[model samples]
Target: MSDFPSIPRLTSSKYFSSLLLLRNIWKGGDLSDDMQFQRVVNQRTYKGELILFAFDLCSVSDALNAVLMLRHVGFEHFLPLTDGAATCEALHALADVKALPTTPCFWSSSSNNHKGWDTWGAGAGCVSGERRRGYCKAEQLWAIRYHVAARLLASRVNLLHMDTDTVIFNDIYTRLKRKPISDYSLILLPESPVNGGLWYAQHTSLDSGAQWVIAEVARRTWEVISLRIRRRSSPPFDQAMLADALVSAMKGERHVAYMCEHPAVALQPPCANASQSRCAYRHYEWVVATLDARNATPLYRACFWRGDAIVTTDEHVIARKQRLVAVH
Candidate 1:
């Protein structure tokens, strides 16, 4: 028996159904419209690989800037996931004014009726304005993010999921493409000790072990959300949930590997050298690769001054992000 509380599968749960209802609301449940949306997603793919990210009205500016930076580095294909028609509309308008050639996939409730996200915290009357506005929290946003990623993976779409605050100096797609796909199911960047901000998920069939790994992570995500709703105390962040899920999988006898990819060296056992400054590990079909801190530093680190890809900014504040973009 599992110690974790029982939660329904994401695709079959009421929460998932509610999210779908919101997404279909804009099109009046038109099949053709859904087909067109799928076409748009496919059209944005570059050699079957695409970039995915989630944002809200609160973080739309950061999202737009992230898109611009991605394009500036020659990344064309992207799928920006967001909630609310206002946020989606604002994102498109910003993209148009900036000449960004990508479409955002809006899949959550609108400004007026946010019943869809009630279980995810919107029902608590959280108004979206800035990152720190109202009762809106990062965990709520992450709940939505993991759901979208799980849905995409279930549909066999390979993607590199990134946070909006990230700044890339090199062509990340080229670097990711070089990694052998058969070697791992997920490629993740380390944030402190847990994986967050940036990661890659490969397309996998419904019955594949890799898909099982994806489902496991999604399951943990829902569990985290459920706990947050039931308890008054703060719950673990999504990053912590991810870390726990991967660790559970490893303990369950799944194949996991760890390597330090920054120096372009061969895979070494966990902590092979006591003197090694940076190290990463992988799980079952999931691979955790660490980038040189100087190249992909997380927000908590002070190495962004000479970083190649700022994994993320400290907060969702737009002004600070804009300054970072200007400097880099």
Candidate 2:
């Protein structure tokens, strides 16, 4: 196991206040129809509680704005995870969510000038399947290793890990239920069976069963990335690592559950007006423009086509662009 340190607890009121201000600035001066938005948000935010973990790069305004929009629609309790004092304060100001300290990340700006780039070590040779691009291999190894360690150290906390690009349209907790008291140990993307897009786990105590599963996955990802280190330079295929680990865990003694749901339909691009249940799943489908042929970003126009079109967006291009630009 890697010896990366776990995230330290925060003790600064100043830092907390700053994150709060940054959050407020991100919100701008928009009026919220709490009732209307709440109706939409209520589906996910039940009293049992759900935690949203978004990893923010330099600025988290985009993800936090997603939280605010979810709140205006009526879902609250979105948390922003950060690695700096300034970032923490900025996020807190904009929303009534928790601001947790950042854990060890894949690569900070400082590593750009480091010597490990060209050197090969056991760390560099971990990739076993498809090769990975340069630098990214080391990054995946470090990220998964550190994140697992951090989760181990955080007592009594259940973590839900998410990338920054996603937005929440419903109360995520309500959809996930396993006997109510014992929630799912792992929840993953439905489209991808082998890999997980989101992860849910209790961090207070290490489950030997769970640890075995996490470690195996991390190891597989490292192998896939490292095997290619001698060939290609860099690859953004961390998801593949996740897939390998998850598949291994299922095959092993510790059978962690993977849940897949049709991501909420109302969250889809506006023009893809297809009903939620009717949507189909399409892999790696990219459209430069919407089905209507109007302009849209890859994600807004691009969709995972399920039978009839399960996942669609209603957000216009201008508004989505504004949201993207408004992030700090």
Candidate 3:
């Protein structure tokens, strides 16, 4: 008999607690025996990797994309953010179809579990105004994501938090090795003038202070950032807050921020109507158009989220499905 504990071990979460990174709000709970994370010492084989991925799958299309990622762009191991049964199934089924050899197990955030009480407090007074509920809920969801991502920082694992909407064409690992993220506290690329789509944080020791900076960002938006959708400018979401926290922590010195522009490092499909005017995720036609245009370019990495857009409501994922069919 194996003398191992029967808990899904989350390395980063444990590291965070060990470092005392949660100076104020870290909550310690009894590990659930029903479904515990599979344990490994660090869960990473190499000492350092340029890009190890973590993806969120909360919807059907997101699952499809996870399959796409595994088939097209190989990932060693990733932190997964799955909010429900469908998302979980899709990730599990990834290896079964398309000649994938094995069903990969992954570590995930505890918040993905269902709740009886109102965990978010009606989106937490984060965003106020008429029609703000939807936006606020989105913010809260992302807040949890950041909260989860912080564990990776605590575990001292370099993580590239990519949305499922993003695609990869070129071999990114080979490229990043040419110019590594060794010096960067965070690797950020502007999705827009005021927004970012992807982030990379290096693995650092408990004393490096990088963990403190990442912790502050998560703490500020622990549950919500409340960036209203109607505003022309960004409304202080987690990305902005993270940038601000890093800036403050770095104290005007080099942020060690490797700011790579999109389309150069990777491809970010413009909204179908982008040539005419800017479009939000609500613009279904624009979303569909971007979906149609995905494979047109030789993209390196694709950041599919549009300014923190909602994943499910957009009707365009249907188009993405059709594209997959045609590929088959």
Write down the TM-score of every candidate: 0.57, 0.40, 0.48
How close is each model in CA RMSD to the real structure? 15.9, 18.1, 16.3
Q: Compare candidates 2 and 3 on TM-score and give the better one.
A: 3
What are the per-residue Cα lDDT tens digits for candidate 1 across 43-154? Answer: 5555556677877777888887766655444454566766444557777777677664434545433221234335545453243542354546555556656665665565
lDDT (0-100) at residue 280 of candidate 1? 22
In order, the Cα lDDT scores of the candidates are: 0.45, 0.32, 0.35
Comparing 1 and 3 on TM-score, the stronger one = 1
Per lDDT, the best of the predicted structures is: 1
Lowest lDDT 10-residue stretch of candidate 3: 319-328
Summarize candidate 3's per-residue lDDT along 47-75 as a digit string, tens digits: 44323233334343464454345333334
Model 3, TM vs. native: 0.48
Candidate 2 lDDT over 212-318, as tens digits, reads 34444544333333332333344234454343333323233221111112122122232144222211112322111111111111123223334423322333221
- Alpha carbon deviation, residue 2, candidate 2 (Å): 41
Best by TM-score: 1
Q: What TM-score quantifies how close candidate 2 is to the native fold? A: 0.40
